[model samples]
Target: MRIALNARILQAPRTGIGHYVAELSQALSCDAQLELDFFHGWGWSRQLPAAALPGYNKWTTLAKQVPGAYSLRRQLDQYRFTRGVSRHAADLYHEPSLWPLEFAGPMVMTLHDLTHVHYPQTQPRDRLAEIDRRVGPAVERARFILADSQFVANEIRQHYGVAAERIKVAPLGYAERFRPREAHALRACLAQFGLQPGGYLLCVGTLEPRKNLAQALRAHALLPEALRRRFPLLIAGMPGWRDANLAPELQKALASGAVRLLGYQPDEALAELLAGARMLLFPSLYEGFGLPVLEAMASGVPVLLTARTSLQEVAGPAGVYLEPGDDQGWCAAIQRLLGDQPEWQARRTVGLQRAQEFSWKRCASITASVYRQALE
Candidate 1:
């Protein structure tokens, strides 16, 4: 079967969805039964673009500030997509993001989360408006829908009334790179950032309101002065929307040297970062599937996460859970985990076993089946 996929997300620095697309595309390509063509916004190609073009981030940021820029860009993208579709015929088109382009073929879409719907204030006005306008119609247009977890699958049924049969829960997987590393092997990579193995706590995600990082910073600050000084909280991600709102608290944390912001580490560096951490702290308010939790688990690190949304599903029984709003609870949990070596070791062992259950190869196998089911 010939498959046309929207690969436009790869044009930017990879976050959750971009990694999904990149990893899934590579896995799907290995399937002998499939012929894949990627629609890279303005053109079609068989090979995926390796990385973001130089200056694409600056250009996108600038474009978002200009009036009517998004609409104009969308129109041009549609024109190019329509023209590309006419030239390269395919049996199905799969959209790995919320908004799928208009397609008259069998369509498959991956709804990563309902964040825009559930937390409207988390999004910028224009982006939220665009999602509000497009997502419902896109859901209606898709023949089959992919959700990252059962939590999000239920959200789809509740919010959009999409039937359970039509929606498939295809959990994501960690890349092979996210495995445990020895202290000796990780020391050099960690040294580059003045980090040491098992010497720092990590929180990995874009800096956004939905990530609830301010809460994490607060919890870290509540640690005893010596504890905070010994194990600094390391945040690894790019600056995202509404990050300025976090300034007051973030500034205080940084001033005390209890928090370090390492913006958007590359995959190689990030994997080492994850593997060397004392533990991974992820207190996201919501998630479709908390990929960072899975990645941390895969790296044989204990995870402390919010006790809500798809985080529980991703972490299984391996995570140390706390409520998002409970600052005192978060502080206590961190203290207990730091002091209890046996508990940490047990969690790490179970996390490694749990990580073994997920892989990109399995995800691709299931996705291929979904494609065939859509055709039927």
Candidate 2:
């Protein structure tokens, strides 16, 4: 079987979908029964592009400012994509993002979340409009749809009326690089950022409204002065849309040295960061699948997360759940976890056990099965 995958998401800095495309593609490539061609916007190749390209963000920011720039770019990309698909002679085309190009072949789409539909306020107007226009048609065209979790599969059925049979729940897997690291091994990397092993709390996600980071900031501020000084909150991700909403609490926390913003740590640095962390905090309002929770679990770090959506599914009984908007609750949970070493170690042990259940090889096997079923 031959497949052409839209790997264009890899052109920008990796968030969830970008990581999905990169990891899944590499795993799928190992299947000897299938041949894969990656379409990187302008052309097709057998190899995936680097995780991110230089100046890609600058180019995208500039493109958004010019009128009709996105439309023109899309048209050109579609033309190139159509031509590439013909030459590759693909049996199927997979779109790992919300927008799928015009492809007539058997289509498999990965709907990571319904964030745009559920929380339209979280998205940019133009981008939301584009997704609104294209997603319904794309869903109708696809022979099979892959969702990151059962929560998302249910959302698809509820919102789009996509049948359960046609939607497959293919959970994401963490890379081998996310495993636990010894303190000695993490010393050099952590030293670069002035971090100490097991000395700080971690919140890993893009800064945006949907991440509910302002509440986290408030909750962290509620910590006792000495506790705050000892274990500061560390946020690791790039600035995303509507991040200004977090400014008030963010500024206050930064002033007191109770929180540090480490914008966009690279993939190479993530394992060490996770390893050295006292715990990972993810209070996302919604998620298709909480990859960071899984990665943190795999790194032998306990996680504190919102008990909703796929976060509960991913974390299972291993996570410490907190209400999204309950700053007081969050503060209490943090205090309890820090003070209780036995409970913390127990959570870490279960987290590691839970992480063992998921792997990219399993995800790829399931995805390959979906492809074969689509062909049938």
Candidate 3:
């Protein structure tokens, strides 16, 4: 079997879909019966350079600033890249994200989430429009679809009218590096950010409306002054598209030294950062799988995630769930998680056990089965 994968997402720092593509590709490459070809670039661009550029998004943002650049790139990918896919002579093309680049072969697309459909307000108008136009056609063309969670699979079925038989739920896998780290081993990395093991709360996600950071700030501020001083909130993410306002209240909390924003921590430091944190604050309004929650659990850290969306499926009984907009509830949960060591330890143990259930090897095996089905 031969497969050509849309590996362009790997050019940027490994976020949700990027992580999926990279990990699955690596795991799939190990399969003796399958030949894997990674298509790292599209349109006029044929491949990514040997070096991994850490700030690839900066260039992408700059390109988007140029009027009509987005449409031109899409056109080139649609027209020119179709030929590239043909040249690979792939038995199947797997797009790890929503949009597939004009492949006529049996294509499988992973629709991670319908956030654009559920919460259109979370994305920019132009981007929403683009998704509306492109995603529908992509769905129509794909022989099969992959969903990160059952929550998203149902969304696709209901909203896009995709047949239930056509969509498969392929849960994400966390890297081995995300497991627990010793305090001394992580001391040097933690010290750079003024973080002490089990001393500070952490939030990891792109700063945007869907992440619900505003409510998190409010909840953090609701903490008693002594608690706030004892454990500050550390945010680690790059700014994503949205008008998720940093309200005056959050600004006040930030100014008072209860919050610190560490934008876009590199992958090398991610394991240490996650392990050192007291708890992962991920009160996302929505998610497909909530990878950070899993990573945190795997790191032996308790997570406070929203009860809504696909979070419950990933977190299971291991997570501490709260309503997305319940600042008071969030504050109380944080206090208990930090102050009560026994409870924290219990959650931590359960989380580690739960995290063990997922692996990229298993993901690859399932994916290969899907490819066979697609080919059939």
Q: Rank the candidates by TM-score, best first.
A: 2, 1, 3
Number of clashing residue pairs, candidate 2: 0
- TM-score of decoy 3: 0.94
Predict model 2's lDDT versus the native. 0.89
Model 1, 1-376: lDDT tens digits are 9999999998998889999999998898899999999999869999998898678888677766876676677788889988888888888999999778888889999999998887888665666677888999999989989999999999999999998999998889999899999899998898987878999999999999989999889999999999999999999999988899899999999998889999999888999999999999998988999999999999999999988989888888899888888999999988888999999899999999998888888889989999999999
- Residues 199-241, candidate 3, lDDT per residue (tens digit)? 8999998888888888778888889999898899988888776
How high is each candidate's TM-score? Answer: 0.97, 0.98, 0.94
Per residue, candidate 2 scores C-alpha lDDT tens digits across 75-106 of 88899999999998999988998879988778
Candidate 3 yields a Cα-based lDDT of: 0.83
Error of 2 at 200 (Å): 0.3
Clashes per candidate, residues 3 or more apart or on different chains: 0, 0, 0
Residue 234 in candidate 1, Cα distance off native in Å: 0.4
Best-performing candidate as measured by lDDT: 1
Query: Cα miss at 303, model 2 (Å)?
Result: 0.5
RMSD list, candidates in order: 1.2, 1.1, 2.2
